[model samples]
Target: MHAWMSEASLDRADNRRKVPEWVSAQWRRPGARLLLVDSDGQVATDETGSGPAGVPTSGNYNAQLHTFLGLVDGIPWFTTEGPIIGPSASLRHLGAVTGGAALELTVGAVALTAWHRLEPHCSGCGARTRATAGGLTRRCPVCGRVQFPRTDPAVIVAVIDPDDRILLGRQSSWDPGRMSVLAGFVDAGESLEQAVHREVFEESGVRLREVRYFGSQPWPFPRSLMVGFVADSVSAELTIDRDEIEEAAWFTRADLAADLAEGRVIMPGKASIAHRLITAWQGRLLG
Candidate 1:
């Protein structure tokens, strides 16, 4: 199956169009729709009655209504929902609704909603910016700076050795025996390839060669674009960085398959680009 089929599809066409009159008419609608919030890495999804009541609000009360590409069954449709935020005094009237699964919501969906609302005021001069192009961008009236949604690039890599073993690292806070690829945010003035090599060396003390790019995923946990790669390890010896990683080592395909079969090793989330990278490597080895 395609990577996006698991999550609700947010059609691009829907996002381009103006909010339909029928949807706006639902402003006074009684029922609420699904809303999800993410602070750091923690996620919470719940229902809210309607969009924010007024424009000028503070704390978690502010809301930016977004139209997302969505699907019901195999048919494509659009969804108009509020941004991610906790319960506020202004939104208390929505009545109680159950929380939804975290994986069901995409980071793109949440970040787009929040950025649209927070950027109304210009960063340069505090002058109020005007929304343009159907909420896709903001134009600063004073400085004339056009601002769009921000996406931070990150690198998540699987380090491979000449012995055909894959390098994995376990964070100090993660459960025992759980291992994942070394990852870090791409710093300014660095390419994705540079970030991959630096992160692997810093976390596991493994020098890499033959670095090749893999696919990317929209990891919106809080606005991250995950760039995946496979790098050849020049050294087989392991050196774990206690501050960032608790353990680092090379594992063979047989070992990984055994662990996966016994549920001893847990892969990253299916929604995560990391999982897809690992799965791709496994396929090649098994073949």
Candidate 2:
């Protein structure tokens, strides 16, 4: 599993939060570290360094450079619009090479940055918003309304038939032969299990039962919280919705191995929860 999929050593005390100035003071403490992410979502990492590399600098905050991410092991960790001191790497690569420290900061920063970029005004009053709560929130000066970072909850389910075959689907827009589990966003008043059932039925004309949670991951490519599940297939029919899915099919472990070797099917990247779910059901990791 990707380390970044899980939480890190940081303690995000959102309930008993510190003020901005207090958070900044942690930067001056010895052994403090700074991390940064580009506008495109890559973490600033040294190409030659081992294990979640980060930029090296004294603990000083540059207003335009750093966004206070949170406390890492009780010390300040910041992200920046960096002219990073060194080369940078993608979060996917970082996951294979490192632990949660760098990955957590990068993901949090990217989420924060996305919110700031996408929301600049209060929805309630059209007032300009400013960073508050140690960069964890945005406040409207006039209405005093506060906005925090938001993650859209989406359910990604690995559906299985009584025969134990796994169901996978491919979107029309995906790369050739790429396949993944069925997924959809939770609707206005629906539960996660309801979304799973509805999405599966709508996309493939299949019904599912026993919707059980598997795990979750932070997929912050423009901010989404991927809630994972495993569901037993009640209907084996394959009726692909042309609007959403181009293809839907069932595969056994042996079939997956053959397709993987022949390059007939491309699995999800290791950085994604889909990959872990697939490997888990197969009773082994893909080599």
Candidate 3:
């Protein structure tokens, strides 16, 4: 399972968030904590660099700069943007070292911070929006339209052939040794299964049959939800789409293991759904 899907430790308290008094009370409660995130989606980490460097939610914090991040163990948690005096790390690195609620909280904090930062205006009308409902929503005064956080859906799949070989591809922008499973964003008026077939064929000319849902991951790299799937390929053919994929190929388990051991190929990191999907197919973690 993805790191963000850990056992629940934070209660979002969606119903109570509607009450301004309650949200304010959560902010002022003892043990209230604040997490700081930069525009690049990196958060300040503790001295150990294993967890977020959270400070007390004190002083007169501007409501626009911070939002409620739910509760951990009945203690309120808030997220804000600001400068800090310590080491900072991206969710990619943090996801590797942290797990459970700590990782979940950090992911939530980063996603919320990015949403509030990028979406401060109304999409319907050209009007500025104000943070409301403890930062879960924004309300435009001119149009009176409320906007919720946006999450774009994308699909990532592992294509297995009749011979039990998995297909992987390398994007042109990546290093020579880097490769991973095929993935693309879902289009309008399209279903998840359609997306898997289209993306696979477009990238590698591999027709798919019997596509099955695997799982999902909250890929908050600028707010995206990655839906994972596994599909059987009709045939193994090399038809690389140089536009997005620089090269494509099918590899058996033995070939993949040898390439990985010899430093000839690099798989996705543990932080991504692609990594999890590939690991599941490979029957073990990739080196």
Q: Each model's TM-score, in the order given?
A: 0.67, 0.90, 0.95
Better of 1 and 2 by TM-score: 2
lDDT of 1 by residue, 1-287 (tens): 13432534433334433444433333323332333433333223333433222221212211134333232232222222444455321211211121122222334435655566556788888888765543456779899988877788999988888888888788989998787888999999999999988888888888987788776766554467788888888979877789989887777889999987898887765546667667778888312
lDDT of 2 by residue, 1-287 (tens): 45344546666656544466666666666666667666676666666644444444474664334557767777666655545556777766655555566556666767776677778789899988887766677788899999878889999999998888899999999999999998989998999989999999999888887888888888887889999989888968788899999998999999999999999999988878888789889983321
Colliding pairs, model 3 = none
- Residue 255 displacement (Å), model 3: 1.1
Error of model 3, residue 250, in angstroms = 1.0
Candidate 2 lowest-lDDT run of ten:
48-57
- TM-score winner between candidates 2 and 3: 3
The full ranking of all candidates by lDDT, starting with the best, is 3, 2, 1
**Candidate 3 lDDT by residue in tens digits, 1-287:** 33444457788889998777898888888899998888788898998888877788887645677798898889888998767668988899888788766777788988998898888889999799999888999999999999999999999999998888899999999999898999999999999999999999999989987898887888788899999888998888768889979998888889999999999999898888888888888894321
Error of 2 at 186 (Å): 0.9
Q: Report the error of model 3 at residue 241, Å.
A: 1.1
Q: For model 3, what is the error of residue 218's alpha carbon versus the real structure, in angstroms, after optimal superposition?
A: 0.9
- Among these predicted structures, which one has the highest TM-score? 3
lDDT score, candidate 1: 0.59
